[model samples]
Target: MKRNTNYYIRKAHRYLGLFLGIQFLFWTLGGLYFSWSDIDKIHGEHLVMEKKDFSTTSGLIAPDSILIKINSRQPLTPIAKIELVETLGEPYYQLQLMTGEYRLFSAKTGHLKPQFTKDEVIEIARTYITFEAEVKETELLTIVSNHHEYRERHLPVWAIAFDYEGDPVVYVDAVTGQFERIRHNSWRVFDWLWMMHTMDYETRDNFGNWLLKAFSILGLITVLSGFLLFGVSYNKREFKFLKIKKS
Candidate 1:
């Protein structure tokens, strides 16, 4: 009976390890990097300006109306938020749409005015990276702000920084986005932990499926099997650190 039990256990361990071997290595490498590196910034926090020049009445106004007034020829795209500001005490509004910046105008008149733009928003994300100099680039003006709506999830605002070539480097938002406070995400390491475990940066389908559970079981088996294959007797050695003696 004991021999039969050992056989089944060994066989089970072997197959489980075989199935999970590659994934185990992936998890090991990813976990190692995540453990040592600052990998929590991948999913940034939401940022909203507290110094908004918005009154409750204006905030209630439809953002589409604001966008149409700014650029009568161009149509207003879907946006995450609308901001009203007083530049040098002059009232103008900013439309914080998906990626590009559009000026907001009075609903009654289609008047374009000098106001906040994308360049100004990016300066907000830069402050979190410890960048000291003011970042003013027209190329970055084309950057698209990323907005994720979870509906019931209360997702934060995220602003991405683009290089001279308009490539992304980092993200920030109010809880982390632009023109808002700088809050790092190291405290929420699980976001990176999830990415490291699944190698899925753009999706969440990796967690909670039967495949992941099965693979986790296999990983556990693989770890045990390798140790068993070594035949390092626990009875003979008090601790593996102690050298064995030959009779």
Candidate 2:
């Protein structure tokens, strides 16, 4: 019975390690990165520029006037929210309709500029970044790409790249002109590691994936079997200890 139990424990430990060893290493390394990596740097804090406060000075058009202008164009829909936002020192009325549509109207001229042009996007990127370099490349992405840092965000975004040290990239909402996400090399590495950790290649966000759960179970078995093997070996005097005779 002792031999049989020892053999089974040894087999379980060896095979389980073989099955889940790589995953275990990945979990360990990924966990270390997650624990030690600066979350702010991972979010591309050093890559992009900080947000400048909007001026709330006088001579700004009122929300009612903007609504009046919107009403003149077409019948009004139920608005979910309305707020004044300043972009590049220009005030605009950000209107969200109950139907889940967002509109941007110039607070000074009350003109609707919902979609931003390439130049406009570049300007927006510049406004948000501290650097003065021109946008190296700009692409309108209809679908989420693998390189995107924020995979769960809404699609139809503008990918603007800068010629900075880290090759920082910024994603902006195509329709709303909203700054969606920022990414750099560090963030890309972190994202890849996160994907491996979760074993969710498609979405990279599902922590409760079947593969991960299976590996976790196997890992637990490996640990428990290792402990059992050690206990068995100790009981059988397999581990040698140097003894000193009392004089």
Candidate 3:
């Protein structure tokens, strides 16, 4: 009966090890990659230029006059947010309405301009990227999936792909006309490994998913069973020693 129970324990241990090995391997590999990879490079920090300060605060149009003109032009449009933003190193007033509308008004003249165009964005990208690389592709990104690299950022961005190594792509907000983020080969690998680490295939950000929870509980049980197996084997050795003495 004792040896029979030992066989069953060993069998369970073997199966459990096999069950958890792949995921544990992923966790280990993800840890190594995350620790060894340079975070700045993964984020494509080297490809971007530092943003210029919101140009000289002085000598700009009066805010009250701009507000009056805006109210007269588009009356009853409730604004959710407003800020002093810049496009192409020139100051502008960005208005975000509660209904998800974006408008840019020149800070100097207070005249509302049309939204960004791809042609206009090329000029911005030329000045934004640090290295001398030609633009490969220019896309207007309006929608994204849950696992998208540009998830949670402002929508309707200009995705400017460059010919630089690592195949870097820079995103600029189409409405705000501001640089958003950079994605590259290194970042893609990091993102994939991150999804594995978090075990959130849908969103890649959720830490408390059902699959991860189940694995964690099973992992704990496996650890406890290991201790139990160790104790059982130790007792078996003692029992065999006593039986030998009697014989």
- The top-ranked prediction according to TM-score is 3
Candidate 1 local lDDT, 1-247, one digit each (tens): 6556557767877787677677777788767766776533433333222354434343334546656554567665667676654433334455566855444454334355533445544654554443334343322222332222111121243445343222223433222123432323442344455555764445544576666777777676677876774454443355534554331
Q: Regarding lDDT, does 1 or 3 come out ahead? A: 3
Ranking by TM-score: 3, 2, 1
- Give me the displacement of residue 109 in model 3, in angstroms: 2.4
**Separate clash counts for every candidate:** 15, 1, 0
lDDT, candidate 1, residue 122? 60
User: What is the C-alpha lDDT profile of model 3 across 1-247, one tens digit per residue?
Assistant: 9888888888887788789989989999999999999999888888788877776777788767888988887783788887887788788988888988787889899887776899888788877788888889999988998888889888889998889888888888888787789899999999999999999999898999999999888888778878878888997789999999999
Q: Compared with the true structure, what per-residue lDDT tens digits does model 2 show for residues 1-247? A: 9999899889889988998888878888999999999999888776667676777746778899778777888966799999877776778888888877678888888888767888887877776776666578999887666645756676677889988877888888776787888888878878888888999888888888898898788788889889989998785663244232322
For model 3 the local lDDT of residue 103 reads 79
> What do the candidate models score in CA lDDT, each in turn?
0.47, 0.80, 0.86
lDDT agreement of model 2 with the native: 0.80
